[model samples]
Every structure is written in structure tokens, then in C-alpha cells.
Target: MLFVNSDKIKSKPLPSLSENTFLRYFSFAALYVAQGIPEGLLWYAIPAWLAMNGKSPAEIGSYVAVVGIPWSLKIINAPIMDRFTYLSMGRRRPWVLFGQLGLILSFLSMSLIADPLNNMSALMILGFIVSFFEVSQDIAVDGMAIDILPVDQQARANGLMWGSKTLGISASVAAGSWIMSHYGYFYAIVSFSLVISVIILVPLLLRERPGEKLLPWTNGEASKAAEKIQLHSWKGIFKSLYKVFFLPVSFIMGVAAFSYSFGRGLIDTVLPVFTVQELGWADTDYSQIFATANLISGILGMIIGGFLIDYFGKVRMISIYMSLLILLACAMSFLKSFWQNDIFVTGFIICFYILLTFTNIAIFASAMQLCWKRISITQFTLYMAISNLGLAAGAALLGPLKDLFNWEYVILCYIVFAVVMLVAIRFINFEKHQKRVEDLEIKHPDINIG
Candidate 1:
């Protein structure tokens, strides 16, 4: 039954640009900014920069593997974040603040450490810690967004957060590269730390609601039913873990994940070597092309793709983008062989990179939307964990494959992956998923937008 109450409807908060708008935008912006800095350090800049420091393609792969481990493992901490709160800030915000603080300190440590021969192991260890905390923050922020935001507002929130994240990433990478180029690695780290420090101030301005869960045991009741479930049953625990691990979406996405990551990891792990050894490009040249491609394409894809997914459904957009990405990858692999001059090679690289930037962002936005709110933070972490695992698996396999068949064959692998992604998207059926979500929203007004 659709319940309509004119007075009651007026009582609920609506999104706006005055006081309400300020709070919503301000708080989310802070979350994204905090997230953006460590994301840049751990995901974007570190691996490539490490390669430049004479690390082999395999070592670079290892770093990518190391950093990604936390994402897959974050399921352990996700539930705890849901059930626990600290210092009166509610469950999610307190942890987010703490995680960002830890990340800032970790980045500072990277800046202070020098003499690669003496501190190489230390740097990798620190990088691992930063990755852990960064994933922790991601868990909390994602959970908080779902837990607090109204269902009607969730779409806008997702779009805005992604858009802001891309912007922050662009700024971080661009600034990090310039600082690293001119002053050294130290300043780049310090500058990111300052950016994160500003991000921490977001919690001071926002409020978080208490957590709750729906339960089938008490006739679909939120409070009493959830309380009735066995909190520490081995069967229950196993089931929760299994539910996320064996999810239908994971299996469907896994095929695409495998292919996408294989191609991406190979390109990332080997590209710098290709650039310096094969093409003789300078460090600044590499940074400039990447930053420009990333900034423009990433932001555009997130905004446009978010709307498209909501409008056209996840499957159609992903299928289209994946095809484009495959074509570009093939072009790039061939372009390198033919174009001896720096100018032509650089142009082709940038064009190939822009295609990747577009498609990858589209993929990520779709994945985020696919997550069900009922999964909880712990399950959410596990979902991200498995996704990372797929990427790492692809990365790990890239080295041996590159040695056996050569880079061109590796590029062919990407084209194959695009085919797999398109095949998977066929199963998504966005209208059905949207209706399911809408039905849930109507039933429980406070349902999280996972």
C-alpha cells in the first residue's frame, strides 16, 4: 500500500542548496577529498613511480598486488564499523576521520624516507599499511553514504561523489607529479598530507544516523527481527560470509574483471618500461600525458556514465564502453611498433589512454550502483575484496604471459576481455534491478543506497 501523508512528507528532509544543500555537498566533498589523496598515492602514482626507480615489471606487479590485498580483506573490518561507534560521532564518521589521519601520517613517512637501497623494504611495508587504512576509510565512507542518505537522493550522491573523486584524483596526480619533478618525492607526499588534513575537517560539519538492519525472522521487522538473529552462530557467520563470496553479481562480473584486469595490469606493469626502454620518453613527458588524459576523460565518463547507467541500465553502457576500450587497446599496441618518432607515439599513447580512462570510470560507476544496500559494510568490503582479487590475479598472470607471447599478444588479451565484459552485461537487466530497489525504498524509507 502506498502511504501518503501530506504533513508527514513535509517533515522529511529534502535536498536543497541552502542549509540542507551546504551540509550535503560539504560533507560529501570532504569524504571524497580525504579518499582522493590516499587513493592517488596508493593506486595511481606509487606503482608507476616505483617503476621509474629501477624496479622490474615483476616488482611493480608485486606492489600492485600488495596494495590491493587490503581491499579484498576489508570485509573483516566492515562489520565492525557497522556495529561499533566511537567518541559520539556515530559508527562511520569516526572511523573515516581516523583512517584519513593514519593515511596522512603514512604519506608523510614515505616523504621522509630516502636512500632506496637502505629503505626499500620499509617503503613497501609502509605502502602496505597505507593501503590497509585507505581501504578501511573506503568501507566506512561507502557505508555511511548508504546508511544516511535517502533513497531518492542516493543517485545524486553517487554521481557527485564519483565526480568529486575524479577531480581530487586529477589534482593529486598532477600536483604530485609536478612536486616530484621539481622539488623531489618528499614535497609531493607532504602536499598530499596537507590535502588530507583539510579533508579531515568534514566530520566537524556533518552528523550521522544510528545503524539498523532488516530481518526476515520477525516478519520483516527492522528492530526486533534483527535482534532475534543469533549474533554468534557459526552457521550464521558462515552464511553471511558465503552470501557475499558466492554472490551472483561477482560471478557475472568476474569474467569481465578477469579480462579487464589482465589487460590493465599488463599495460600498467609494462608501460613505463615500454616508454623508457622502448620509446625513450622522459619522466615529465609521461606524467603530462597521463594527468591530462586522466583528468579530462575520468570526470567526463563518471558524470555522463552515471546518468547513462541510471537511464540506460548498467549492461548497455558497459557493453558500449568495453568495445571502444578494446578497439583503442589494439590501436595502441600496433601504434607502438609503427611509430618510431616521439610525437606520433605520444599522441597514440594519449589517445589509447583517454579511451581507457573513459571505459574504466564507466565500469567503476556501474559496479558501485550494482551493490545492494543489505550487504552491510562487512559484505561490501568482501565485494570490493573479491573485485581486487580478480584484478590482482590478472596482474600476477601478466608477467609470465608477457614473457611467453610478447606484448602484442598481451594486447590481444584485452580485446578478448572486452568480449567477455559485453557477454556479462547481457545478464544485468537494469529495469528489473531498479524496480527491486524502488520497491525496497517504498517499504523502508531509510533503506541504504548501496
Candidate 2:
């Protein structure tokens, strides 16, 4: 019979969140990397591959739009995660493990599909499944982040998480493009599966803070105690959801989330097609310029932007960044008209990525600040879902817009979205919302309002 020293383990103090910087940062970074790989594959690599394979711009846009639906609908998964968790296995770790396993299996399945292009419908279904797992994993990760990190450290954690995600995308895009060019789609899928398998180890090894419940496999007593503590109830869950969605500051923040990226979505959908077709660039070339360079710039932006948000405050930093983005969009349009030089185009793209990355990091950090500890996963995911919805809406419309309007007109639309986003930001009162969250935490001291 297998035996373990439960007394010794129980006597030991669990590692505190701030006690180990490497463990904390590395864990968050690795999970974010796992999340980013599939995104890079579906959002960046596959679109280029499909375009190269003779898929029309409309088809590519539609494919992305359809697959992206899961991300925008992640709010549905968020509430479930918030209400239920395997406390013994770790509140969020179990979901992370499940999602990672799903990702591996989904990729493996894709590798087995002999002809994805010929079976476009099947490919899209697989894509949707992959996104479902990805977004589910994201929900768990965000919840864990809120629980573990102290208020002072959240911004830095957000930076590391986003930077790691961007780096993962860069690696995936570069590797996927090269592999697809050299070998085939099957090999690319195999490579992704292997990378994800490695990332799964991070969450598996993680342990919840000491004194928390453990799964039955770890310790029976702790699990039983965890079961007795009721954090989930239908009425309470709905009440929390209602407050998060309807509260003034939170409602405005949600609007900002939906508006902030609306323009970028339009630009992102068309840019890949334009680069490959009009610019006469190969898949690898576009990947290197757009994916690799943008990701590198984005990593820097996240780090810098995170610090700026923490220092200068979210509202101020976001305003500055968004204003710059508006100007950059107009400048990009002008450059397209007059300066067709490759060097200038590449430079502009890099600059645009830097500003975009900074803006996104700021916005996300702002969202994190708005989350209520009791239902952080649901609240944060709701904001993120709205952001994704806006992006997806823009992407879905890009194909139709392109067919009807010229490129210049599309750029103008981007500017219009930016202006609207700026207006929405004015409605959000970060300080007021933060005070309310504090008040809630004070009232519910028993809840782990991290």
C-alpha cells in the first residue's frame, strides 16, 4: 500500500505569492505562452497560409471570425469557473490542466487530418474547439492571477504575462511559417503539440498557498473541509454577475473594452491579405515582418507600458496611448498613399505595433483593476470578451467593407473607431470602482478576495 506523511506536509507553510518571484512570474508567463501559441497559429500563421493557398480575403476573414467566436463568448465559461473549482487540486490549476490537455489533443487531431483545406468545414470546427479550450484556459489563468498577486504587483504581472504571450506568438509564427514552408501542415501541427506539451508542466507542478484545501489524492481531510465552505450558489452568482455588469464604473469600463480595439480589428484582418497580395510578399516574409517584428516590439511595449500604467495611472496612460494610435493610423494611411518604399512600410508597421502593444497592456491592466475578488474570473473575462467581440465584429465586417469601400475609406473607419473609443474612456471612473471593490472585500472578509 502507498503511504505518505500527511502530518509533515500539513505542518509545512505553503509558499506565499510574494515569497518567490521566479516561481510566480515564470508560472504566469508559461501559462500565457501556452495561451498565445494557438492564437498565433490560428490568428496569424494560418491566415497567411490560407491566403497563400488561394483562399479569398473574404474566406480568410470569415474563417477567423467564426473561429474567434469562442473567445468573444468566453464570458459564458468565466461564470462556471468562478462558481466551481477543484480547491484541493488548486482552485484554478485543474481547469488549466484540462484546457492544456484539450489543446494538445486538438492539435494532435489536426495533425491527423490529411487534407485540411479540402475539408474546410472540418478545419473550422477544429479551430473552434481549439479556441474554446484556449479561452477556457485563459479564464482560469486570469482568475489565478487575481487571486495570487497583490494589488501593487498586478500591473507588473500583467506585463510579464502579456510579454510572454507576445513572445510565444513570435516563436509560433516564425516556427510555424518556416515549418509550413519547408515540410507541410502536418509537421506544423506536430510542432505545436510538442511545444504545448512542455508548457503543461508549469501548472501541474504549482501548489496552492498553504492552509488551502487539497484534492483527495493529496489529502482527504483538506478536501472535505474545502467542500463545506460554500462559495457557489445560483442566487449569489447571479447577483455578483448583475452587479459587475450593471455597476456604473464597470459598465463604462465594459464599453471601453468593446470600443478600444474596434479599429485595430478592421486593420488586422485586411493587413495580412494586403501584405501578401498587394505587397507581393511570401508567407515567410510577411510572418517575419509582421509576426516576428511586431511581437518583439510588443514585448517591449508591454514591459514599458505596464510600468507606465503603474506609475502614471491607467487612465492617463491609456489616453496618451490611444491618442497616439489615432495619429499613427492617419499617418499610416498617408504613407500608403505617398511612400510605397518597403523600408518605410516596415518601419511604420513596427512603430504601429509598439504603440498598439502599449495601448493593449494599459487597457488590460485597467480591466484587472476593475475586477471584484469574489468573482474575478467572471468579471475580468466579461471585459476581455467584450474586447474580443469588438475585434471580431470588425474582422467579420472587413471582408464586406473591403468589397464595398476602398483602402483609404477603411483607414478612415479605423480613425472613427479610435475617436469613439476615446469618448468611451471618459465615462470610466477607475478610482470610484476601485473604492467600491475595496468596500466589497471588507464586507466579505471570509471570501478569498485576492
Candidate 3:
């Protein structure tokens, strides 16, 4: 239902790749790899570890929702990142560095805390702080990536971030889980902290190009306005916050994200339980299988997804992939009998894993393409935040549904979601999107299209 007119604005041709270009790409990718470490830890380690700790679905759902709230509520920070700059360190670099430090501290704090479930209230609060800083780092990194990269290489930049991040995620999920299962949580925490500390140090060697035009705060004495703040201004702060709350692209991205996240959240929350309760799989076995899926299959999917986005363009590929995901979800929903049968379960799981790999690739690629290069990261995070919200929503609803219905019936609920998602994907036409971009260039002369 939403149409973006920015695509109509034309910019100069993006530069061709040279030796310098390759160096920049590689360096940025390496930097991304480090940032990716914590992200992977959060995604893979946190969720699975919680499930293993005997957290109920509703409790698990609430925790995820709490963590993701920063992303949804603080999307305003993205635009601020767009408008603001740090004078001394660099535009994005300072924020990235600070965020990285926060990540290490958060992980250490979580690791030191003895019992996640027992100290649920305090742990949840700390988890929220971690998610906030993690998301904040994402905003800066994504905005910087978008601003610095050439238009043609947008997908490549996206690929680097996604591929690297996913690799980190798979490692943490697979390897981290294994280590946690075998060794104590203390050992696992210490080992992870050490690895990430090394990764976070990468930014010391690199830098981002600041915006061409310096703003008032960067050069002018306009910053002294901060000294003028008074208690009465809080009302005005709320009003400004209200106006900044809605961004068009973010709103659309949020809608798509909510749909995607809700569907995904339901599957994630229930799957481990299903594996244990229904399939009778052991932790070690599930860990092995999960790791294998992520290590080999996830890497391949991410690499292929990058190339495919560049070849076919982001919107087209993403729409196709999203549609495919809906199909996959529906198929899984109705295929419950396969899970019950010994002969079919193994093969069905294989198919399901493959489907998940492909679905994630497409979703990521489409999301990258959907957002213009510079804002792609911010938009991506917002989308992710909204999706996480949907996931929480699904988790909250699924518990009651599970209590009232059977496993087969609970999964069948995905059918309704899949159908709805497919319809949403249908509304997105890539060719038209590309044309709209072209038209926007022709019409709008002032806005910087990139």
C-alpha cells in the first residue's frame, strides 16, 4: 500500500571498482566481522540458552519482546544518526566503538550473573540494556555503510554485513551451544568474551569519511544551546518526539518486518520444544544438527543470496524469496504427520532446514534491496525490530493457543499467516519499484538520492 517516490531521483553513476575499492570493501567487511560477533552471540546463544534453561514459551516470548523494544521504540535514533556527527573520532566510528565496548560489558555482565531464570527481573533489565546498545551500534554501522558504499555495490556491502553477521551467528549457535552443554556457563562466557574482544579492536585501524558539510555542533558554537535546557522543555521534547516518531520508509519497513517477524517468532519459539517433546531428540544431537545446518548450509545460502541480489536486483529477489518463505511456512504447518512418523521425520527435517536457509537468504537480500543503500542498515534494523516484535506477539499468542489446541492445530495457524504474508509480497513489484526510482530522480532535484 505504500509507495516511495525517492527512486525517481537520479544521481550520477556509481564509481567502478579499483584497487582502492577492493581494499575499502575488504577492510569494511573485516570490521563488520567483529561487530557481527556479538550479534551472532545474541541471536544464536541467547535464545537457545534461554530455552535450555527451562524458560516457558510465554516467558521466552516476553524476554525477546523486552530485548527488541529498544529497536522499535528508538528508531528515531537512525534519523539522528543521519543528521548528527562526532567531531573528534569520526561520524560513525565513535558510535561504533562505544557500542562495541557496551557489547563486551553486557556479555560479561550476563555471563557473571549466575541464574538467568531465577533472577528473571534483573536479568531482563540488563538484557534490555544490551539490546539497546546492540541496536544502537547497528544504526551507526548501517548508516555509515549506506553513506560510504557506491550504489552498484550496495548488495555487496549488504552481503558483507549479512554474510559476516550470519557466520558469527551460526558459530555462536552451533559452537557456543556445544561448549555451553559440555563445559560450564562460566567457561563458555569467558571464552566468548575473549574472542569478541579481539574482534572489537579492529576499528582502531580504520576510519569513516565524515559528511562533506560540517554541521553547527561540529564547528559552530551552536552546541551551547544545550546549556539553555530547562524543566519546562520536557513537554516540547515529547511533542518533537511525536513528530519524529513516524518515518515513511521505516513505517512500510516496519509493516513488512512485523509480518516476517511474527511468522518467524512462532516457529523459533516452538521448534526446540517440538524437537524435544515430539522427536525425542537429545540436546547433543540437536546441537550437532543445528550447528551443521548453520555451518555449511547457512554460509552457502548467504554467499548465494549476495550474488543473487546483485544479479536480479533487491526488490524482485526479495519478493520472490518472501513468497517462497510463505510457501515453506504453510508446508511445514500442514506436514505435522511427517514429524510423528519415524521414517519421514529425518527427511522432513532436512527439507525444513534447507527451506529455512533459503528463506533467510531471500528475506535478508530483499530487505537490503528494499532500503536504499545509505539508510539500508537503519531500515534493516527497524525492520528487524518490528519483526522481533511480531515474533514476541506470536510467542505470546501461541502459548494460549497451544493450551487450547493440539500441536497439529497450533502449526496449522501458520497457514493463516503464510497466506497473509504471500498477499503482502504480491503487492511489491520490483520492476515498478525500479521505475519509480528512476522517476524520482527525474522529478526531485534537491534530495540526495543515495
Per-prediction count of colliding residue pairs?
1, 2, 9
lDDT of 1 by residue, 330-377 (tens): 776676556467676666566666556555545554455545444446
In model 1, how many backbone clashes occur?
A: 1
Quote the lDDT for 152 in model 2.
64
Top of the candidates by lDDT: 2
lDDT of 1: 0.61
160-233: candidate 2 lDDT, tens digit per residue? 88889888887887799889878999999899999999988777655645444343466522334334332566
**What TM-score, over all chains together, does every model reach?**
0.69, 0.80, 0.66
CA deviation > 4 Å runs, candidate 3: 1-32, 39-80, 87-90, 104-132, 170-191, 210-254, 278-288, 319-337, 370-379, 400-406, 429-450
Report lDDT (CA) for all predictions.
0.61, 0.76, 0.59
Q: Please report the TM-score between candidate 3 and the true structure.
A: 0.66
Candidate 2 regions exceeding 4 Å error are 1-19, 43-69, 114-127, 180-187, 213-215, 220-230, 269-288, 332-337, 395-410, 438-450
- Pull out the clashing pairs in model 1: 72-385
Flag the better candidate by TM-score, 1 or 2. Answer: 2
